[model samples]
Target chain A: MRLFLLAAAVFALPVTALAQEADAPLELPPVVMSTEHPGEVAVEPYDRSNAHAGATPFEGTAMLEAFHGVEGIGRVVDAMIDLSIEDPRIAGTFVSHDMVRLRRVLKEQFAYILGAPVDYSGRDMATSHRDIGLQAADMGALVENLQIAMDREGVDFRAQNRFLAKLAPMKDDVVTR
Target chain B: MRHCQSIGVVASLIVATLAGPASAQMFDWVPESRAGGKLLLTGGVSTIEGSGGGGLATWAVTSGYGAEDGIGGNVHATYVNLPDYELRSWGAAASFWDRVEVSVARQEFDTGATGALLGLGSGFTFTQDIVGVKVKVLGDAVYDQDSWLPQVAVGVQHKSNDQGAIIAAVGGRDDEGTEVYVAATKLFLAQSLLVSGAVRWTDANQTGLLGFGGDRNDDVEPQFEGSVGYLLNRNLVVGAEYRTKPDNLGFAGEDDWFDVYAAYALNRHLSVTAAWVDLGSIATFEDQRGLYLSLQVGF
Candidate 1:
């Protein structure tokens, strides 16, 4: 009888302690959302369908992936270079002797847009453009060309604007004649 | 028999401890009966008055602490961008026992003005220090689930412009004046909307630290502020807001304005927001529209 009572008390101790701790405020787990594809759905109660049903779809990760991959990046880079060459204004502003530097800038920008792991280590945009003499007209043209490139890749307008917001602050630095 | 008595005594003591002041104090912070401890961050741009006038479009970051029932506080920093000058302000606030809030802020306006206006060459700067207090007189915006009336609060911001020479040159009356205001704010949880309206009574000429001169009677004018947001998930909110201001200064006409904004809660510790503002013209200054963006990280 004595042994059974002792065993019962020992067993009850952990349960009671757990009950008290459970009553306290437990830390909430970090919420993670799916980034696999634009159409992928998350499981509920982790689902945000009702809350974010109206959100602009996620496109940055996929776009970044396309830039990182050899074939996709090659095609996009060729198109960008071809467009720049065809447009004298773009050619004047983007005049670079180092193809490697240009490629690296493009890669860094893609990574930023895709929320990937990358840091931009290029020359300061303002200092580089100090001698180029870009006007508002040139800025407008650059936006248009970027828009065309985004459209070719099926990027939505809102998502494109989100990306542009990150780049807009550079205007102050880049447009100083 | 002695062991049983000892167990009984221990149980009684535990029950007594559970019913003591410690437990009661814990309950006070639990946010029960109130939607407490919500950290709110907000900013917008508008004309200082209701007509066409050029005022600084502002971007601010603020964070609220504690519960609606108990003591709460907030700290904010603002940057105002103008055509010729830039103003920066930092402030801290405290709300005591959930009934009163007191705040203090310091401002610096630098124009880098050279060869302009009264031999006050480049590096001409204007500074102001403001002290504010607010009291919640009636109504609750969040917890009174059955009512439509929002949380109504009355507050005052007293400003002391440090530019004594400018005030003297402009023939201003007092370097210090109080702006007393009443505001009503509501949160529509279902629609993810926040609406607010306010009226301010003040003697200060402009919302800017530069005191308004001339024969202007201390008058009360109605100001309105409202926001409608769409929750793009729990972490992201896309919204718009419109706020009105009193045209205390007669130099330029003040016109109210509106903004479209989007905010993403990166986590509990960080948030990023962007806004497109259409600030109505100040007097002859048309197209006072611009973009405002801000990022906030908190613990």
Candidate 2:
């Protein structure tokens, strides 16, 4: 009897409504859970699809906000640097690295690329690593580490791609081998 | 005779390309082949009229294998069979500088038994030759998937029907006409979806088979076409298209066209498309519906 009731409820949903429900949260997380007033009963899991307009998380400003200001960008760069040093493919490049200086440059580069007002005054990509043998494998490692850091930071997938698109061109300057 | 010569040239080109050391088709498995910056499936299927589009509507994508800074070309053969009519077509298209496309197609429309009703012999057919050119004027459909701006193009198709005598006898005022169209197509990567819409200004009746205008209506009218496609996987795309057409002939009413289709890329060299199509009415025949199959091989 319980199974029958469950099946009945599932079948009762209009296909369009079910489609909207499935895709709505998959694109943008609207309401995981919400409660404002405790005095009266509150509607848990509110439907806010129409409540917001032109504020999709994919907008440039919204994407920039996901980094949680300069602090979060710093954390992302730190994670990437840490992961790069652990990966066997590019670990040797970081063996003699100055962690503090690299972190600051990465933060500035990311901040400028993500639409922050800050200017990146660090050395151009080639000038900074002129002697290092940056091979294709090293570039691959850098990309993988950056991806992992973005995932850890809870950055929206679209925002991660937007950031990576700007960095992809740097490969020409960095990867000589 | 001219049509036969054109067919021979296109057929020879297809064979020569297939047998050559170079593969003109975009083979995704060989990523190095696309050093010129083109990607797989960005070149859409050939429309029935021989432009880059879905089954029935023209899209904004450039045709053939050419990418950002090169030239690419391809040939296609399409067959459509309905309850009372059939259409066979062959064409070749080329994309240059990844911005402009030019194509030519020859269509043979078999009236079947309906020819007998029109006082023409059974199995009588009408033929037309079409020349088309499109110029990409805006955004990139593939790389700009993260944004809402779609790729846009504007084009024109000039069609000339061969059976001028029969066409005039059936109330058609002219044997030739041109279609001017503007189309936009976009790809949304996250949802694996592609949607396109186009508006066209045309005066042709039965896609110019029975010819343009008539004693009934002599002016060009605007029509619309749209498509929605979903990628089931990298190798296949399933979609549906609808195109509105004008009814300028007083002899019989015309209905809009629609199709649901699946297109599969076997490799860059070849792809096959099959669709269930509804063309509404042809001549005086009612409720025309059938299967559409097309085979395209390219480099």
Best by lDDT: 2
For model 1 chain B, the run of ten residues with the poorest summed lDDT: B50-59
Tell me the DockQ of each model, to 2 decimals: 0.01, 0.03
* Predicted candidate 2 versus true structure: per-residue lDDT over A73-115, tens digit per residue: 8889999998988876568776534454467657777776666
DockQ of 1: 0.01
For each model in turn, which proportion of the native inter-chain contacts is also found?
0.00, 0.00
Checking candidate 2 for backbone clashes, the offending pairs are B24-B299, B25-B299
Q: For model 1, give the interface RMSD.
A: 19.3
* DockQ winner: 2
Q: How high is each candidate's interface RMSD, in Å? A: 19.3, 7.8
